[model samples]
Target: MTQRHDIRLGADIGGTFTDIALDVRGRLFSTKVLTDYAAPEQAILDGIDIVIRDAGIAPGDIGIVIHGTTLATNALIERRGAKTALVTTEGFRDVIEMRTENRFEQYDLDLVLPRPLIPREDRFAVRGRIDAQGRELQPLDEAALEVLADVIAERGFGAVAIGFIHSYMNPAHEQRARDILAGRLSIPISISAEVSPQMREFERFNTVCANAYVRPQMADYLSRLQVRLKEMGAGCPVFMIHSGGGLISVETASEFPVRLVESGPAGGAIFAADIARRFGLERVVSYDMGGTTAKICLIEDYQPHTARTFEVARTYRFCKGSGMPISIPVIEMIEIGAGGGSIAWVDAMGRIQAGPESAASEPGPACYQRGGERPAITDADLVLGKLDPDNFAGGKIRLSLDNAGAAIARDVGDRLALSPEAAAFGIVEVVDENMANAARVHAVENGKNISENTMIAFGGAAPLHAARLCEKLGVERCLVPQGAGVGSAIGFLKAPFGYEALASKIMGLSKFDAGTVNAMLDDLKATAEGFVRAGTDGAIVREITAFMRYAGQGWEIPVTLPDRAFAAADTAMFETAFKQRYARFFGRAVEGPEIEFVTWSVKAQDVRPEGERFVLETDGAAVAVPARRGVFDPASGTVLETAIVPRDTLCPGARVAGPAVIVERETSTVVTSPFDAVIQVDGTILLVRKGR
Candidate 1:
């Protein structure tokens, strides 16, 4: 027997919309509201009110609240975080600015780089020296930190970040500096030893600085949100989803806000993985396209790929090393500024450019008619007749076709010497190509071929272009799951309470130190379990991975370790594991090279529920069509009559041919000529190529 008292709520705030989902026992209710940048929590509150009301539940009945947001990522990209100061080891104040000294783009002589978050004037160094082996060569200068605290206070800094050299090996210096500074200054402090605790001084330092930069803002917002929720009678325990696709206590989220950078997209990836698992699918591609960006992630064996480090706000969208790297557990994916509100234009070379930029929600696409004059992807879709002007957002928002055409004519059509319809088609095609290129690159990087993987498309704009994306990628099938528009929010509701802890200590396989390594792993495992226990008393599963590399190699590949204690005799097993994992990428490993372990990670999470298999009700009678409309056909470069069918009217196994529009309350899916759609038992719209 199930109790109705276990009510859970989820909120996901993206670049454009704030989605809210309420799981009352087993039934789910959701709503979407435009994100209010000025007071982002207001949108969450508004959406929450709607969903809980529609669910026929009072706020007091909600026992848990889970949230994920893109505010940290946006602030880092826009350089709008709090006034921050950084404390570093003596003579290394510029390590973040220096970066790794490797040029990702070798040919560009005048390439610009991302600016460091903390400027030189605000970065102060204390006399402290710690060796890579955790030896304190020079004691931290307490008096110098006192002076630096005055300087920080004089500059009115809201937060301070401490990143001493070799802190990942030993954090004593950073911890002392933080204590001394805390005694003198009244501001939040973030230490690399606590935030990242990983090797690589530059990435570790920048990550702490980033965590400090956004800590104040996130703390304030979270505080107010708690108060508002309490007022609304939903004063339950509030948790946050991190970029690693794990739930954490709000306290942890406020302390290391940088972990939330890719939180929203992480949820989307989790959603796709859950969908794949529900249908027993193995190879899956998760595509999430919202108003401001699109994210592509690969899922294998019912899990989204995980990364120990990821870049944020890349100057070059596809360039690997062009952004600020943060060492943290994160969902591996590629994000591009190609989405519904991506502005379309003709670049200097007269080539059509979609974007690494967006209009966002406020002053959104021109067709939104909220003061935007630029042509965006949504406007192009409208001009191309793919979107309904009068029935947009379930008639909640009335789109303007005139605005869409005018903006397209001015920005793209005129420059290309083409009609608005032609320009719309071109814009849509260009954006589609951009997304496809991202997908292809991501696939190759992951040693995958997308032609064999099924695409799970979601978010507000994904289904709108998913069919075409499939065509471009040569993917035979794409599934737009139920509540696709609020997919990430729904994912949050289903996510497990988990956390990851990392530690770095260089060791060789020849002298395997199992005792020392096991001690470290024990501490990390306990840390992860503490976080998971904060959410529930369910059984916890633990996974350990080591970053191993051939001695003298610049990088290491993650190797999953088998559960149980390691012994001296396990050295051969270690070598075999490294070679096998290495061969998967480089075709073969270099034999006889000394192997070393650089970093170790431990993840702990609750056991996930197994989804029940469902069969489509194919025996149902034929469903009725809702309406009919004219949609632009890119194949013919002209408007063609399209059947407008309400998604509710399409029950399980209901089939609809191409050149149709399936309308739902949140978003619409355009079934192109090359594909046909069938409704699954779980309300997923499965689009398969015709005659396949």
Candidate 2:
């Protein structure tokens, strides 16, 4: 009864690689190619070509194509976007510069925060003002805007951002400014009223600026990709994944490109949730380590945790509140600059230091021998004999062990007076610890204890490092899902066509206006449904979310409304629900304090198919045999002969005493002494405590 014409394709473009997947009736096929930063769409086409050929399906058979990429995020971080300008209220031209004045690191007297994207000269203020109660205090000046438009035209800015103070509460002034600019210039304009209608001026302004900054670039790329796909005989609808784990129309993505900053990682979270659902896992931590970055996220009850805002390119790789924050619904996660291509070096203290910077794929690590002379994490893994040089990347790219040794010896061994092997071990250990530290911090911040949660590791580099991370985080089990190397791309196949719309309105619960609130909710619901319908074929949409809050809660918590709209009788119900969620999070809802709704969000999603459950193995065991290899264990402080086993040879329920290595095709797992390892029913390696 099933037709082959309904195949779905998904792709995730990262800094180092582009992963592609095709799913036909729940069966999946995937492939990977080096990301062509110069022309990213070329990489997508190449990978798609391979996958479709492998699946033996015609391009026209594809019904839908879903994509997630870090192109916007990379453009923001690397400052490689369109030349853009910002328009704001006359008195608040520097709001982006005057970010929240709190120092995330208080003890350091001199701390450097991230610089605002818009420079002082590019920030021009238009005459306008709005109150917190959706009232326009001063009308937007038309004559002033005419002069500003000429100035912008002279500068030839590609895009413009308008973020008047309190515009979130009252968008009239911002909308008027946008209209003036639209007529005067041929460039796209982003208004804070729609981009981030939240009470926080700093976050709202940043979001608008980011959207403007990347709009031109995203538009160009998506247009070209559409043309290319059509030429390839593919007539499928193209949808882009948003940071909130939902698919949006390509047009929407181009308009608000900032929403795509965490798009790739969001897909990985969705993939982990799918795996968790298949096995009935209640709590899981998804770990995805690629070549340039490692991302960690928490999933509770098969849903990735979501946040109203996310930071990009933190100066301190693992520190929160140290980067630019954009107000968008994103899957909450922590990312560190520790990954496969992270450079390894000896610091002034003669200790090994792994990165917050990457060599990337061009020259890549020393083992790649693509003209790179620097030692890197991948090089270290090769030096330790953990990676098969000839079999790297399924032998698509050969590795050079000599090049790795030479780079490590010259850069690290010479300074530390240690052998290359020892230096490689040091780099590996430090990077693993950095990843573990990030995991620990993210868990604590989210009120989670990782010891009880199963670790689902994916991406090309994760399985290689999962066991070590588990040891550091005190986790007992690790699962490498099928097609783990291209996990995020696979995740795109599991996401629903969805979109979220938010607006800022100052409303007090004590004096709630039901009619006004109902109208606003109705507008947002329709907006979300319009987006979902554009990319999906007559799929039904489901609405979900909640209010965001503080302790007396002058600001309200983002509360999830029931499936129905606000009823005249439900005002009290809304208040009660808000109070209960507030108390549950903070332990107490202060009495007699008024609560205000800062923002309201409405999300619309298309229902997806249920995944089949796979059984766990308890009786079948892995045939364990240990081959010896010299490895430097930090705990022992010396090189020792360690036992190694082939990962595939191990059957479910097979136990291996640790101080062992489990090698697979793409990656390896290391089990240290005092921790015993077993193959779980789902083909994942479970390392648990044993009587040593």
List, in order, the clash count of every candidate structure: 0, 16
lDDT, candidate 1, equals 0.89
TM-score of candidate 2 to 2 decimals: 0.94
lDDT of 2 by residue, 474-528 (tens): 8876777767888999899888888888777766666677788778888888988
After superposition on all CA atoms, what RMSD does each candidate show versus the true structure? 1.8, 2.7
User: What value does the lDDT take at residue 572 in candidate 2?
Assistant: 78
TM-score, candidate number 1? 0.98
- Specify the highest-lDDT model's number: 1
Q: What's each prediction's TM-score?
A: 0.98, 0.94
